[model samples]
Target: MLSSLTPIVCGIASLGLDHVKLLGNTIEQIAWQKAGIFKHNVPAIT
Candidate 1:
């Protein structure tokens, strides 16, 4: 359902925003968090 999808979308967006905010302090952590946000088999640059 659309309601169920909302949390998934919000989680992905949160990971991305958190990754950016953490970049200045920790590059490795950002990499891990970013990987969590991305989908496998899909090409992305971030």
Candidate 2:
């Protein structure tokens, strides 16, 4: 038998105002951009 497991990972310690501004200056926009790094249907604990 074979089994698979996915481990939780953390990236970008923090997203500063400058970074958010570069991404369009809104929390929602920044979140959308950062969310691009993860796979679809996977649980995220932000």
Candidate 3:
């Protein structure tokens, strides 16, 4: 079992560009995917 909405800190360092770049994914799209892990009341450092 996992705790949901526990207000944990999340940090995103980098999104692999060289690999996924060939897939035709835009930088904004990749940023969104990385930022999607953020939750309300949680501190996220990108």
Worst 10 residues of 2 by lDDT: 1-10
* TM-score of model 1 vs. true structure: 0.34
Per-residue CA lDDT of model 3 for 1-46, tens digit only, reads 3388575798888776654654337777777777778887778886
Tens-digit per-residue lDDT, 1-46, candidate 1: 4364333332323333345655534666665655675555445553
Error of 3 at 35 (Å): 0.9
User: 28 in model 2: Cα distance from truth in Å?
Assistant: 0.3
In model 1, the clashing pairs are: none
- Segments in model 3 whose C-alpha atoms lie over 4 Å from true places: 1-5, 19-24
**Clashing residue pairs, candidate 3?**
none
lDDT of 2 at 5: 57
TM-scores, one per candidate: 0.34, 0.45, 0.60
Judged by lDDT, which candidate is best?
3
TM-score of 2: 0.45
Top-down TM-score ranking: 3, 2, 1
- CA lDDT of 7 in candidate 3? 57
Task: Report per-prediction Cα RMSD to one decimal.
Answer: 6.6, 4.5, 3.9
CA error at residue 28 for candidate 3, angstroms: 0.8
Candidate 1 C-alpha error for residue 18, in Å: 8.8
